[model samples]
Target: MATVLLAVLVAGGVGCALVVCLLWRFHRALDRTPPDVGAFAHSAATRTAGAAAARTSSARMTNLTSALPWAVPLGTSVADSCRTEDRNPFLGPASWAPINCVRSTVFYLAFDGDIRTHLRQLDAVLAEQEWVGSGSSLNTLTGMATWLSQAGGDPSPAASQQGSTEPPGSRPICLSTTYGPATQKRAVPHGGLGLRLQVAVAELPCTPSAETGDLQTDGRPEKSPVEGTVYLTWHPLSTDTVSRSAYTAHRYVAALSLVDGYAVQSTSTTAPPSPLTR
Candidate 1:
C-alpha cells in the first residue's frame, strides 16, 4: 500500500511540472512573435476606411461635373455629343507614381456658333461660379479636331489633317481658371485644395464617309455637321501625393502597433508565470 501511494505522488508531481512547462513555452512564443505589417494593411478597419474615402471623393466630383453648363446651340440640330471622364493621379512631369488624391474629368460638346461668343459665354458662367481665369493657350486646330474625332461616330475633315499647311488655319484657344472656395467648398477628407477648370474651343468640319454612315443605321445620332467643338476639364489643384502617402503609411503602422500591443497584453494575462519556470 505504501509503495502504491508513493508512485501516485510522483505521478502528480510530474503532471504539475508538465503543465508549468507548457505555460512557459506558450508565453515565450507570444513574446517572440513579430507584428505583421501586411496583415495590418489588410485588416477590416483599414479596408473599410479606404473604400469609404473613394466613394465620397467620387460622389463629390460627379456632383461638380453634373452642374456644369454644357454648350448647345439654339435652333441648330446637333448629334453625337461625346463626353469622357478620366482621373489624373500622376504627380509631376515625370509621371512617376499614381495617387488617389487628384481627380480630373473631361467633357466634350459640339455646337454651331462663333468660337469667341461661346468662349465668352463660358467665361461668364465660370465667373458666376467664382472661378478666376489663370491662363490661356492657342494651339493649331488640327490637334483639337483630331482629339474630337476619337468619339468614333463620324470623321471630321479637320481630323484628317495630320501636318498639312492648309488655308483657313484656325487656332484653337484654351483657357485655364482656378475656382474660389466662396461658393463650392471642398469636401472633407478628400485632400482637395480647390478646383481648376479648362475650356478648349475649336472649329472642326465633321462629315462621315459613306462607310461610316452605313454603320450608323441604328438611328443613333452621329457626330457630324457641327461648326465647332468644345472640351471642358476640371481637376483639383492640390497634388500633394507625398503627404497623402505618408499619412496613409502612418495609419497602417498605428493600426499594426495597436493590434500587436493588444495581442501581447492578452497573451501575457492568459496565465501567471509558473513557479517551475521561474
Candidate 2:
C-alpha cells in the first residue's frame, strides 16, 4: 500500500509540471506575434486621403480646361502629345509641331482673392472683350459658367489650404487664357476648324524669407513663404481654316504678387504682331 501511494503522488506532480510548461510556451508564442494593428490602420487612412486629394485636384484641373472650349480640342491634343513624349519616345516634337499647327497666344491674370471668385471675375473680364466669341460661336464666359456649375460646389478646404493661408479670401489666384486666330489654323483634309489652345496651372514652392540676423545669432532656419504658378498654352487646330483674322498671335502674359492683402508686384506684357484689322 505505501509503494502504490508514492507512485500516485509522483505521477500527479509530473502532470502539473507538463501543464505549466505548455502554458509558458503558449504565452511566448503570443509575444512573438507581430503587433501591426496601428501601423496597418495608419497606412490605410493615408492611402484613402491621398486618393481623395488626387481626385479633387483632377476635378479642378478639368474644370479649368473646360472653361475655354475653343482651345480645348487643339490644346488637348498637344498636351497629350507632350505627356506622351514625356513618358515615352513614341512622338517627337518635330513630328508633332507641323501637324495642324497654328500660331498661338497665351494670356495670364493673377490676383489675390478666392479661387472661385477670381474665376468668375476673369469670366466677366473676358466677356467684355469682343474677340473672345460672338453669336453662335464659342463663348468663354458661358463655358466658364457651365464648367463651374458642373463642378457642383466650392473647392475642398484642404485643397484651398495647400501651402496657402486660411480665410479663403486671402489666397492668391491666377488665371490664364491662350488665344489663337483662325489665320494660324492648319488646313485639314476635311472641312472643319483646326484650332488648338492649352492651359495649365501648377503650384510652385514659395520663396524663403530673408534672414535678418547673423547665423550665429539665429540658430533656426528661415521659413519660406508659399508660392504657386499658373501655366497656359495655345495651339491652332489641324483642321481649322485660315478665314477671317480675329485676335493676334502675340502672347499676353501678366503676373501679380500680393503682400499683406496688397499687390506688391505687378507686371504685364503683350508681345509683337498686333491683332488683325477688324
Candidate 3:
C-alpha cells in the first residue's frame, strides 16, 4: 500500500511540473505578440465617453484641416470630404488629443501619369509631411520600389536592405492584422504590388488626458489594420493606359484619409505615462 502511495505522489509531481512548463510557454508567446493599440484605444474611448472624453470645437477642426494638406501637384484633380461626429468610435475619447478630435477628412487625387511618376509625387508629399522612409521611416516608397523591381523592373535601390530578397508582391501587405494563412495568391493587375504606402504626421504634442492610452494609425484604414492615422493609398493607372479616356475616367487614383482636429489632453493633473504608450 505504501509503495502504491509513493508511486502516485511521484506521478502527480511530474504532471504538475509539466503543466507549469506549458503555462510558461503560453505566456512567452503572448509577450511576443504585439499589442493591438487601436483596439485598446477604441475600447477605452467607448468606456470613457461620458465623463472623461475630449471634445473638438469647430475652430480647431478648421485649423487642423488647414495644416494637414501638402501641396498637390497641379493638374492632378483633387476632391475631398470632411466629417465630424460625436459617437464615431474613431473620433475618440482616448488619451491622445489629436486622435480624440471629432472630425476626419479624406482626399482623393487622380494623376494622369505612370504609377512610377505618381509614386515619386507621393514620395515628395510624404517627405514634406515628415513621414519616415524605408531604412528608418518604414513607408511605401522603399517597399513599393522593392516590389516594382520584383515585378520585372530593375532591381530596387532599396532591395539590398530587405531581410528577404524573394518577391513579397503577392504576400499579405498589412503586418498589423491577423489573417488566416492564405493559399491563393492575390491578383495583380499591373504586374504586382509591393507594400502598402503608410506615413503619419503627428500633431499637438500636449499633455495626455485622464485616459492613459493613445492609439495612432499604423497605416490607412482601408488597406491597413491600423487606425487613427493619416493613410495614403495609391492606385496604379490601369493597364489600358493607351486610351486617354480610360485614363481620365480613372479619377480616383490615390486616397489620403485621416482623423482631423487639434484636440489635446486638457487635464491639469500629470500622471505617469501609460505603459502602453511606451
**Candidate 3: residue 204 lDDT (0-100):** 15
Which portions of model 2 miss their true places by more than 4 Å?
1-101, 107-110, 134-278
Per-residue CA lDDT of model 1 for 1-278, tens digit only, reads: 99999999999999999988887666555433222322333445434443443343345334433453443311111111111111222221221111112223333333433444444454555445454432232122223334433333433344224332322334322222233323435421222222333343433321111111111334333333312211111221111221133223221000000000010011113221111100
Candidate 3 segments exceeding 4 Å error:
1-99, 133-138, 148-248, 264-278
> What is the clash tally of candidate 2?
11
Error of 3 at 182 (Å): 37
Per-residue lDDT over 13-127 for candidate 2, one digit per residue giving the tens place of the 0 to 100 score: 9999998888766655542322222232234432343234334324433554455433312221111100000111132211111111011222222222233444455455444
Pick by TM-score: 2 or 3, better one: 3
* Cα lDDT listed for each candidate: 0.30, 0.28, 0.29
> All candidates' TM-scores?
0.28, 0.24, 0.28
CA shift of 23, model 2, Å: 80
TM-score, cand. 3 vs. native: 0.28
Model 3 lDDT per residue over 72-140, tens place: 321211111111122223222323222222223233333332334444565564555433333333345
Candidate 1: segments with Cα more than 4 A from true spot: 1-100, 135-192, 204-278
Q: What is the lDDT of residue 13 in candidate 1?
A: 100
